[model samples]
Target: MTATHHTTVELAKLARVLDRDPGDLAFLATLPPEALREFRDQITDLTARREARRMQRVGAAAKIVPAPIAAKIAEAAFGPVLAAAIAGSVDPARAVAIASALSPVFLADATLTLDPRRAVELIAQVPAPMAAAVARELISRGDYLTMGNLAGSVPDSVLRAALPHASDLDILQVGYYLEETSAADRLLTVVTDRVPGVIRATHNAGEWPKAITLLGLLGPTERSKLANVVAAQDDEVIDGLLTAVEEADAWDTLLPVAAGMNPQSLQRLAQRPAMQNPTLLTKVADLALTQNLWLSLLPLATHLSPTQLHTVAARVATEPDASLTTLIEQAHTENHWPTLLPVALALSTPDRKRLASLPVMHRPEFLTAAIKATATHNLWPAALPLLNNLPTTTHDTLATTINTLTDTEFQAAVQAAVQAAVQAAPAADCTATLIQILLRQDFAPRSRSLTLINEAGNLETLVGTITTRDLALWEGLSDIRTEIPGHLRNLLAAQATRCGRPELADNLTAT
Candidate 1:
């Protein structure tokens, strides 16, 4: 489309708003006089004002976003008022309504433009109710981020139209939400639209987890796209790319992305060693787990903490019919505990106790750093709970290894812990750990009282701990021995069995 008479003036205003170099704008604006008039007419089309208001409404609804995101919206609008429009305080419904009206105008006229980044930022900011409008607008534009971001809200018809036009990278992006939003039907539909080959190209900027998830949901046709994208990247994106591949073992194609994961995830990914035959996936999961990237997996991979890993280690594996201990044993051959231990301890329950039980020499700086960090950040409670979980062997050792505090000093620390414990809704694990210690170190307890078990939030572990011990010591407990002991014995044994120690379990003979 040729520029109309006012092309220079409009171009200058747009350039100023877009914050482009003035010379660049003048150069882009330079057109034949006749062409300039035509372009000006196009720019002033009623469609232009209509579209501007529509984008303006989107900018208006984007007020909820933090300023940085709002700024991105501004940049993406191709000089439209993303920020200023969003801040106007117009009712949200009105803004979306106006924005939808102009979407088709901007979409149909190539000369009538909208920024993909700005459009996405705007779409991402729209309220959930108006999501369809945002999705519809995004579909008309047909950018990768737009197609992807609009996935959840777009109508199936628009989505279908977008599928064929989509490149592999676009499929990965949009497909990510399909997989994550748990829209499996959409995910499968996308797979059908995909051209074969998993293309591993650099996705346009934005967090990539959802896209990675989408990659996992792909069937054969889409995988061809994944292959293509994989062929396009430097190694860093390999983790993301590999993460997607790690989901299913149908290696009808070479697994290129598997090279980038951390040791732990890689280790998990490598269980089907035959498909990802490089013999290096576990090594990468381990390295990644130790590095800061390990934390990223908590939100994206799984929220497994060390303590959680420890307590449910058996169950976690069992539930899935996979044995975690076996994997740990196998992983030990190639992986280092330093990376896995610290993160698990920090985030998982089983790992926390496991670390707390570790001999000092066996522990690494990372473990110490995590513990010291809890202390330094006034997060003593996080560490204090682990103290309860410490095995008897480790409890005795930690006491000695801890600074040579006298009885008085130790009492003071316990008092502090007691206060902290009281503030917390007590836990069964904490009670069980303390009970284990109590059983090992019998006495009229001082600061670390047996009654503290009652205070801990978990009743099952409390009942389990009390039942396993001879309850004869507590007051008024002797008469019920025949009645309680049998029941308690049977219950404790049953609980233990559920906890995965059948041999240790009591053979409940109907009490």
Candidate 2:
């Protein structure tokens, strides 16, 4: 070949690397962005040409052609395009021989991009060194979508035999393959499953949510096994658990999480209970109320009922500081009415007479609790004096407590003007908290239950609670639609569909 032709080929290769249009100086300045990209994709692979050259030389050795004429093919890094094409032909023996001759070229052209399926097919026919080279290239840069399909395509025996000699000296071979397979759960198994490279890929892929879901093999047992991993890493695994929860909410996936004491850890996270809102602190109460120690409920026994009062009272009855009769006596006089009621309610009971006689400031709280527990006239009559004394804070508490009251009490309060009671709270001070609270459907926040988000909040700063509640109620109503009732189960379906969340949209519809 002429020196000019060799120079031109070198220039084309350079142009390909720089992603420029092959030299036509007259038009170079005019190339559009689209034209530049096209030029780059067009020249990215030199494998075909390299393979052809090798085959041509091999063919020459069998022919009368002079060796110098064939020697031209020996310079390229891979088999010439003609050789790969010939090897890729249906003749298996010829394919193997062609690959064996080209193995060295593959090792040299290590960065050559390969077709995933084609590499899987052609690698088997390749000589060992060449197959290793090709496998390394595919593992490093081939399309991830092809990993599982390709792994399963190969007979595991041949693949396993080839694995030890694979170019994957570290774990990324398996990493990239696992990534391609979308099976991250296999990471632990890959680590302990006696597959070195496989585990590395699995470990890396475990960090990504999509891959973990694909793996489908991780369960509660595996999570508990890995609990001793670093906290930061454990957090990452928790994130994976969170995604699994959002996707399936399965029991197996839920139970093993207690190992990590995370902030979001809510116990009994079986399928979201039949009720949308479950009392979270009730579990905390459970841990506290269990019967091992007698004084577990000592600090707050005055608020509990005859049955409940006695049960927890028995636990605290042994307190060295106070006699059981002293505890009962203090509860009788109601010096500690407020604290006692909350404790009583937590225990699912209220000292009925003491709760009824609580200060005007506290009457709404206990009455509201009693109302919710289906208590009757006595609870309502006890709450009446507090009607005018109720502050906006107390009103916020009563919003919830009122919901628990008997319909008769609810009617009396509504007649007493709940609309006005809501208005009395400073619009700014209560607006944000009330909005968030109502969003959660928690109606009561008595003087005792409220934290008073801002104490210095002025009258101007006080948000009228009614307006905020109305806005939240409307917003939720929009989401909790029932336009098509009966068999048409979901009203949110139409909205979800318009937003491209068909899965959520479908949940809004009936079968």
Q: Go through the candidates in order and give the C-alpha RMSD of each one to the true structure.
A: 19.5, 24.7
Q: Write the per-residue lDDT of candidate 2 for residues 22-57, one digit (tens) a residue.
A: 564334434443354355445444544556565455
RMSD of 1: 19.5
lDDT of each: 0.40, 0.36
The segments of candidate 1 whose C-alpha lies over 4 angstroms from its true place after superposition are 1-106, 110-112, 115-210, 213-278, 293-440, 443-511
Give the alpha carbon lDDT tens digit for every residue of 1-511 in model 1.
1122124334543443355554676765656544643453454455345666774666555656554454444446633343333323334354344444344334223212333223444434454434434344554565333344346544455455545544555555455433123343455555553433323333334334444444444444544444444444544454554544344321212232333334444444433322243333333334333332332222212223333333322322222213333333333433333233333334355545554444542233333443334434344444555566554556444433333333343333344454544454333235344334334332334223333432334334335433334322222222222333344445555665666655445333323
What lDDT score goes with residue 462 in model 1? 35
The CA lDDT at 45 in model 2 is 40
Candidate 1: worst-modelled 10 consecutive residues by lDDT: 472-481
Give the RMSD in angstroms, all C-alphas superposed, for model 2: 24.7
Estimated TM-score for each candidate: 0.27, 0.28
lDDT of 1 at 292: 26
